[model samples]
Target: MVKYGAFVLFYLSIVWIVSSCSSSTVEPDAARLGYTYFPLEEKSFAIYEVEETIYSLTSTPVTRNYQIKEVIAEQFRDLSNEEAFKVMRYSRQNTTADWELDSVWVAKRTANRAIRTENNRSFVKLIFPVEESQKWNGNVLNELGADEYEFSQVAKPFTIANQPYTSTATVMQVNDSSACNMKRVYEVYAQDIGLIYKEKILVDYRQTNNICEGLGDIQAGVQLYQKLLNYGKE
Candidate 1:
């Protein structure tokens, strides 16, 4: 459970050469750019409530909820000698519990893109101009298979946790639904607040006679959801 849980929780980023291919693009306003959604300034931190659910074929499903804090600790040169930020993560059972150091990840935002390195996989999280219907390669830097990411709902106002965000965008990464299996992954970022929400769902249903008998019953899979609770810069 620990291995799969930790592996699924991390995020990924990419190479800078990927070209932007817009499909009926809706131009973003000049004031709300893509990089603002994921500010990488040192000492910036955000807290989130992470809920994870695991499903099994032989037993009932199990779920766990906890809180995590991610802080941009320091700036350093990555292997490629590019300027990057070191993000330290802490975990706790709840808000009242003390945070314990959990893991470390790297992130960098260039003039036109934002990149995150988690679990040794780098993926492009966002691209510049914040245009709706714009697509870019998410796995260009790593050996992982090609994955396309698109931006939608750009510079749109949203309300969460009783707080109103002036501008936000959605990164639609993957959406695959089948009779026996379903998988989806996406992340939302609010302008000036970084990642506001994320959800990843993967499920496998038991099939009989090569057909799904229990369409809604899970055989084995995982579901993870994260929502921002607070954010600040120190």
Candidate 2:
């Protein structure tokens, strides 16, 4: 009777352990959480103000500013057989001018990632569970030859164009090479609001083979940035 009781007790302990392990392994819904950072619902839209600057050794620096509006127009199946939202983008030289259709972009969200395609190049912009210091190749499938991007900030507060965001994520990409010069791009996103800010800068330097012998090397650079101004929902 004593041996039988001991065996029964061991069997009960094994069942308890298995049950606990199974419960612990269960994960929350990744798709639901990922969509909060990159919403792709039809008729959702955002507007931004863009600033561009160009620096060259041959002439003075040039600066231009504009505004862009992005709206989710429809849905379609992407090449990967996934449902993607088609976004229509419009731009204007200023707020006073009328918006002109600029381009169409595609965005899709999966259980683990959020992707956006522009100009025929697809990019993985966000990862699930939104953690800081998480790194992935934003241009992995695009063949853009860019470096791995990093989530430098998560759930941080940021403001753009006088509008404040309580929680935001910042993804940073820095690519420095002798052949292609140095470039850095920053993309900031707010929960349920999509991208709020974007900045890109590229710098290249080389010796000038001109008649001016004392001019030495020439430095040329370009910077482009966008800030969120307003948004609307359907």
Candidate 3:
């Protein structure tokens, strides 16, 4: 989890650059904007909870319920999957929760080229995991947690935790019906702590990205989930 702090640092630095430019007369170079994280090409490990029901404290109650999951991983910057998984397993083994491994995933790269309105070109790279079904031609629909999904072509503005951002040209590279795309929004959240750039899949829809992979033969899904939670933290 400490490693995630570095990812936070990178995001904070980006925000600083933006703020510094906004305050000064100097025009920022939009072309120079980009992001990269540790475990650069290795793999990512974390923990996740597949919720069974919707719990509400208010009288109105929630009309819908979805699985709740936790992903703790090294925040993107300069890190490795080994570092993330080691820490994650240690944490879980020491924690009080009776959590067990849910799934394990291998990292896959998905790079996208975006042309800004100002004619600035930037490339965004996302490293996620591809589940067994997505990679192999095995079970179709008969499985419980596997489903195909599609994403919107239009871009949308959203906030992470609370920070605000403008995410243009939305894309869905993964297809998992269990994942939610509407309630959760992918964005770049600029907080006092740092910048958190990730995809917040809706709680109802646990969709996966084509950029991700579930290659390794391990069942420690919780560890991988936690790794993702800490994706931007370290």
Q: Which candidate is the best by TM-score?
A: 1
**How would you order the candidates by TM-score, starting with the best?**
1, 2, 3
Candidate 3 lDDT over 1-234, as tens digits, reads 788999999999999998987877564322223212212222233222222223223322233222222233443321323221212332233235555544432222223211111112112222122111122211131233432232332224545445444543223333343222223333232212112343433333222463323333211121111112333332
Q: Worst ten-residue run, lDDT, model 1?
A: 11-20
Instruction: Give the top-scoring candidate (lDDT).
Output: 1
Off by over 4 Å in 2: 1-32, 175-182, 205-218
Which stretches in model 1 have alpha-carbon errors above 4 Å?
1-32, 213-215
Cα lDDT, model 3, residue 72:
38
Residue 25 error for model 1, in Å? 25
- lDDT of candidate 2 over 102-155, digit per residue (tens): 999888988788888898889999878678898898888798886688887688
Q: Per-residue lDDT tens digits of candidate 1, residues 1-234?
A: 998766655422122222232322454443456668878889999999999999988789999999989999989998988899998999999878999999898999876889999877888999887889999999998998998899989988867778888889999898887888888899999987889999899898888888885567788999999998989997
Question: Of 2 and 3, which scores higher on lDDT?
Answer: 2
User: Predicted candidate 2: what Cα RMSD to the true structure?
Assistant: 8.0
Question: RMSD in angstroms, all models?
Answer: 16.7, 8.0, 18.4
The positional error of residue 152 in candidate 1, measured at the CA in angstroms, is 1.0
Evaluated at residue 185, the lDDT of candidate 2 is 82
TM-score for all predictions? 0.82, 0.77, 0.26
